[model samples]
Every structure is written in structure tokens, then in C-alpha cells.
Target: MTQLTLDTRSISRGDGLTDQAYKVIRDAILSRRLAPGTRLSIPELSRQLDISRSPVREAIARIEYEGLAESVSHRGAVVVEIGLDELVAIYDVREVLEGLAARLATRAADDAFIDVLERNWQAHRDAVEADDVEQHMKLDAAFHRHIREGSGNLRLSENLRQLQGQIRVAMTTTVARRGGMPAALAEHRSLIDAIRGGDPATAEQVAREHITRLRESLHDAASAERHHNNERRKP
Candidate 1:
């Protein structure tokens, strides 16, 4: 009996109930509050959200279409379970796209955007100090979003957004095992310095290398987990 806790006050009349429901459910999934493979029942969600079943159904459908959830035999829809291999695959594409974003942002960003990046970096430092993984994840996404949006390429930003959603799903499952946050912070500092220096090539290179390091970190984490599991199973 897995309970899905949702804030009922998040939905309101004439507020595009379907979209609202979708956002609420999506946030829950990303936050791992709903968790992987948890059943998403339309009736239950409607009751909890205090909304009509129709909107809830539509929201679930949209989530399924986004690959966030899938239909199982006799179980209706459940949150999708992302594995390490899938996360690595997503990072492969993300590396290229994010590199391009960093290059373009460096070329096009103004002083105001540089200031924003500095502010974002400061907040990220605070999150790391507090050891708030969730807040750190949020700030990390915001930091990337700022760069992609600064790239002045709407299509690229949209594609990255889709990829980011999948990344969030995969990350929630293995984030505990991944212990490269400090390394990531240092890499981000390097990228920001490149961006501030107006060096597009350096920015792109640093960004791509950062992602490569992250992908490697995933392999290291998975390997360590396997070793731990093997030790635990020893007689």
C-alpha cells in the first residue's frame, strides 16, 4: 500500500486543471515522492487532488506519453523505472547538446546574464554546504536552463528540457550512490569562468568534459554498488 501524497490546494477552478494536475504529478515523480513503479490511479488521484477524474486521466496519459510512466498488465499506469544504462544513454546525448548550449551562451550572453550565472553559482554553493541533495539538483537544473536559454536557441532549449526530465527520473533512483557533487561544483565553476571570459570554445570543451566525467562517475558508482552487493551476499 504505497500512498501518494499530493497537495489538494494545488489545483483550482479555471486554472487549466489538466495542466495543473500534470505538473503536480510530474513534480512528484521528479522529486521521487511518488517513486519508481508506483501505481497512478486516476480515481485515487482525482480524489486526492479534489478534481474531476477526466483531468486526472488526461494528466496520466500525458505522463505516459512523456515516458515518465508506463502501462503494466492489470496494474494500469505506474511511474517508469530508469536504470543506470538508460541514464548513461541520456547523458551521451546531453553531453553534445549541453556543449552546444555552453558555446552559444558564451557567444551571446551579456553582462546581466553573467551576473545571473554568478548568483546561481553562489546559491549552488549554499545548497552543497547544506548537503541538500534535492535543492542541489534543482539549482543544478536551473543553472543549465539559464545557459540553454541564454543560447538564444529555442529549439535546443526545448530538446534539453525533454532530456532533463528523463535525467531527473533516472537520477532519483541512483543519486544516493553518486558522490561526485563536489567535483561537479568545481566543473561548473570552470564552465562559468569560461563563459565570463567570453571563450566559447573553452566553455564548450569544459561543458562536454564535465558530462563525460559524470558518465564515468555513474559507471564507478554502479561498479561500487555491485561490489557491495556481492560482499553482502557472501557466506
Candidate 2:
């Protein structure tokens, strides 16, 4: 299976073995190298990473907590599949929380964080221009991370951080069908402007609107997929 094909080089030597194992497995899920329902075998992963099963087990436990994987009855852990309803539900809560984060960040964000946001925006634009989808995905997450951190609410930041695994899974599974990178970038730009202007209401509005549009796009994709499946069944 693709999940078994771990590239050890990707794991940073500076981190602990468990963190290294966690990152490799997590990246595989986010990058779709390990598609939904793939079984994550501890022995197999340990063999590939040339490490003991202890860290690999710990990593899988963490992935489970992050909602990327689940403990099957007898199958141990497997990558999770998010249905359209659940996906929409996640975004529903995210829209409100992210809106609040942006609202709080508007006044709380300092020059350094703003500078980081600006740099991230520029890098994200470059990634899009170059058609580097992987880099763009990373930058997209970074943009949100920076904003949430700037909110100065540790609880909120932790909450969003927990949501990230599912968010990444959703993005990977649906991004191809969504196909509106430029539109997303524009929304990010608007969000940046609102935060920079220190306009709490505008910032919240922009952030909420951004997530709402994403939810809409997912619905559109699901409809199209259903239509295609129905056409196939018509014969």
C-alpha cells in the first residue's frame, strides 16, 4: 500500500522518533498517499521507518485523536472517511470559530504577526502562480495558523489546531473538484486586509464568508459527483 512507502528522509533528524513517525504518517494522510480506509499496521510502519513499534503506536494514537484515523474493531487503525454531511458540519462550526478568531486577531495582531501574514500571502501567491499545489496547501494552512495564533486565545488556537487534521483530509479529498484556488486566494487577501485595517466586524465577516464559500463549493462537488454516478447507473 502507498502508506507503507514511507520516505524516511522526510522526517527531520532533529525531532524525536515519535514525532518523526507522526509527521511521516500525518503527511501521508494529508497528501493522499494514504487514502481513506487504508490500514495503518504498526509492524509495517515500524519496519519502513526502521524504528520500534512503540513510537509508531504512539503516532497512530495521536492521529486517531486528530480525527485522521479511527480504531477499527479488529483492524486496529485506519484512515478515516468524512461523509459530505460530516464535512459540512465541521465547516459550520469552523466558520463561526474562525470568524471569531479573525475578529479577535484584528486588534490583537501586532506588527510581527502582520509581517508574517504578509510574507505568507506573498509566498502563497507565488505557489499558486507556479501551480505548486502542495506548497499552496501548506501555505494555506499556515495562513490560518498565523491568524489563529494572533488571536491570542490559547484555547481557540488549540481547538482549531485539533480541527486541522480533518481540514487537511477534507482539502485533499475535495480540492481537485473544488478547483477555485484563485478565488480562495482572493478571500485570503480580503481577510488579510480586514485584519490589517483592525476592523473586527469586517474581519469576522470576511473569514466567515470565506468558509461559507468553501462549504458551498464542497456541496457543488458532491452534487456533480452524484450526478455522474447517477448517469453511470442509468444504463
Candidate 3:
């Protein structure tokens, strides 16, 4: 397991302590810092952050509601481990909805939204250049999020936000696995160019193609893993 510590500086700004704690813990879980199935100790986190247990407790509750943490009997909260079926389900839904977001974002194109995308893309490039996989994954997630929010479709944005939290591990895994980062970045650059050109059709097409490929890959990987598990169990 990687030693994933909370970045208190990022969380400490502006937001309430509980929200800060929640985001910190959530990012750790998403970045595979805290990792799946790791036991969470409220008192421990509180001690580490020099904060109170109440905020940590509240953060855990919010995390639980978002399906990122599970309350184990006598074991406290543990990060949720995503299974094969959930990975497939996540990519399936994400491909369609994210494509829709890209299309809608094209329609919503303006200086402000485009700025957010460029900034995120630049940050991602820096992360990749620095070989900081965790920061790269964080920017990758943010890159998708900007498109969703820029879509001007409130419901669509909200839905993806909920769904992304649930399947964050998959996104992290996809980027962290290596060898695909540059290709993914090129795809995103293409996406940015399409959106900047205000061509909704091209934007949507590129977005769909990117996600569809990922979905298929994840599906195949999951299937293979499940098969291996079954074989092991039989022997």
C-alpha cells in the first residue's frame, strides 16, 4: 500500500473544516493513496490533521453517502473496493454521458469555459512531464469535470459528478497504469481543439471515441480478471 497522506494546505483554504476533510480524504481514496479496503480511523485522521473528530466523522458520513466508504461492523469506515461489474457499469454510463457533455459544452462554448479547459490541460501536461502520476490523475479527472460543468446542462453535470465519485478508482487506474498517458493527452488536446473550434459534432465524436475505447478496454480487462478468478477457485 502507498503511503497516502492528506494535503491539508489544499483543503484548508476557504471551505469548512468538514468539507476540507471530506475532500482531502476523498482525493486520497481516489488517488489510491488511502486505497480500497483500507480501514479509516476518525481519531487518527483528526490527530494527523490537528482537527476535531466531529469534522472527520461528518466527512466520513458524506463519503459513505457518496459510496466511497463503507461502514464495516466493528471495523469503522473502509474505502470501497470497486469490482469488475461496477467498472463496466461505470464506463458504460460515463462514455455516453461524457460524450453528451462534450457536445453540450461545444454549444456552451465561451471564453470562461474554454479557459478552464486550457488551464486544466496545461496542469495535466505539467503533471505528465514531471512523472507525477497522482497529480496527472487529479488533473485528468478535473479535465472531464470542466467539460461536464461547461455543458450548461445542470442535470447532466450533477449526474456525472455523482457518478464520477463512485467510479473514481477506475479513472485513477486507467491513468496510473502507464503507457497511455501521452495518447490520452493527445486525445484531450484534440477534444480541446474541437471545442475551441465550436464544432459540436467533432467535439462529440472525439469525446465518444475516447470513452468508447476506454470502455471496451475496461470491459475486456474485467472479463479477463473474472475468468482468472474463476479458474483459481475451481482448482
Candidate 4:
């Protein structure tokens, strides 16, 4: 197990310990700083974060609810691993919600909204050019989130946030396999054009296709990783 030192000074009395701990752990998990299957020790985490084990335990419980961590009988809490079935399921959900978000966003988005989307898409492209996978992930997330917000459906937006957590895990696997960002950025550009043109059908089609391609790329990457790991284990 890898240990991380949390900044105690960053912890404040305002939001309570659990919330602060939750945010710290959640961000690490999402950003892939804490990779999947990493065993989490409450005592070690409590000492590192300079908090009580109760709050650390509470934070871990919330992570479990978010599907980012799992509790084992004797192993305690560990970051959840992305299985093939889980990956497929997550992409399937994204395809539906993203398609709906694009369709709804087209119905109500103003020129300003489109402009924001375009700017975010450009940022993603720039990140890709720089070969900054982390920045590319952040910008890519921003682009999709912008669409969800522009959709004008609060419930849909909330649902998309929940769905995004699962998709992010799969994305980490994909990034490990496919090292380039141009193809994904180009797909984003295509989707943006469809949405900006106010063509709901085209927007939906593009969104679906984009997610489908992501799913395929992630699957290939995961398979390759498995093969590599298997080879490493061979005598």
C-alpha cells in the first residue's frame, strides 16, 4: 500500500473533518493519483491526514457509495478496480445521458453557451497538443459538463455527474493505453459542430459515436494492460 501525506493546515473547522477528508480522498481517486486496487488503511490515512479515524472511516464510506472504493472482509478499504463489465455498463449509461444532454442543450442553448463550449473544446485540443494527459482529462470533463449544464435540466445534470465518476475510472485505463489526445479532441470538435448547428439528431448521433469510440479504446487498453501484467507475472 502506498501512503500519502495530507496537508493538515488545509483542514478547517468550518466544513467538518469528514467532508474535508472525503474531498481530499475523492480528488486523489478521480485524478488517478491513487490508482485502482490500492489498499487504504484507516489508521495510516488518519495519521497522514491528521484526523481522527472516525472521520477517515466516514470519508471512506462515502467513497464506497460513490463506487470508488470497496470494503473487503479482511483487507479493509481499497480503491475499486475497473472490470470489463463495469466499463461497458458505464459507457452505455454515458451514451444515453450524453445523447439526451446534447439533444436538450440544442433546444435551449444560446450563442454564449455555444461559445463557452467551443472555448473549452479548444482548451482540450491545446492540452492534447502539449501531451498533458491530466490537463486533457480536466478539459474534456469541462466540455461534457458544459453541455450538461446547458441542457437546462437540473436532474439530468445531477445524474450526469454521478455517471461521470464511473466513466472517469474507465478513462484512466484508456489513457494508459492510447497515448494520444488528438483523436478525442477531434471527436469533441465534431460533436461541438453538431450541437452548435442546432441539429438535435446529429448532436445525439455524434455524442453516441464519440462515447462508443471511447469505450472501444478503453477496452483495448484494459486488455493490453492485462496482457502486460500477465507477462510480468511469468517466470
In terms of lDDT, the best-performing candidate is: 1
Could you tell me every candidate's TM-score relative to the true structure? Answer: 0.87, 0.85, 0.78, 0.81
Off by over 4 Å in 3: 1-15, 115-138, 170-172, 175-179
Query: Which has the better TM-score: candidate 1, or candidate 4?
Result: 1
User: For model 3, how does the per-residue alpha-carbon lDDT over 1-235 read when each residue is reduced to its tens digit?
Assistant: 3344777776563449998898889888876788788888887888877788999999999998878889999988998888867877877888889889999999989988888889889988888888887787678888998899899899999888878887875443665333567767888999999999999989989998888777776777788898999999994
Return the TM-score for candidate 4, rounded to 2 decimals.
0.81
Ten residues in sequence with the least summed lDDT for candidate 4: 171-180
lDDT of 2 by residue, 98-150 (tens): 99999999989778878998999999999889888788878988999998988
lDDT of 1 by residue, 167-193 (tens): 888763333544556666788899999
Tell me, what's the RMSD of every candidate? 2.8, 2.9, 3.7, 3.3
- Sliding window of 10 residues with minimal summed lDDT for model 2: 171-180
lDDT tens digits, residue span 130-224, model 4:
88988987888898899899899999998888678866754454555444478778878887888878899998888888788777776676678
The per-model lDDT (C-alpha) reads: 0.86, 0.85, 0.83, 0.81
Models sorted by lDDT, best on top: 1, 2, 3, 4
Instruction: Please name the candidate that would achieve the greatest TM-score relative to the true structure.
Output: 1
Per-residue lDDT value at 146 in model 4: 92
Select the stronger candidate by lDDT from 1 and 3. 1
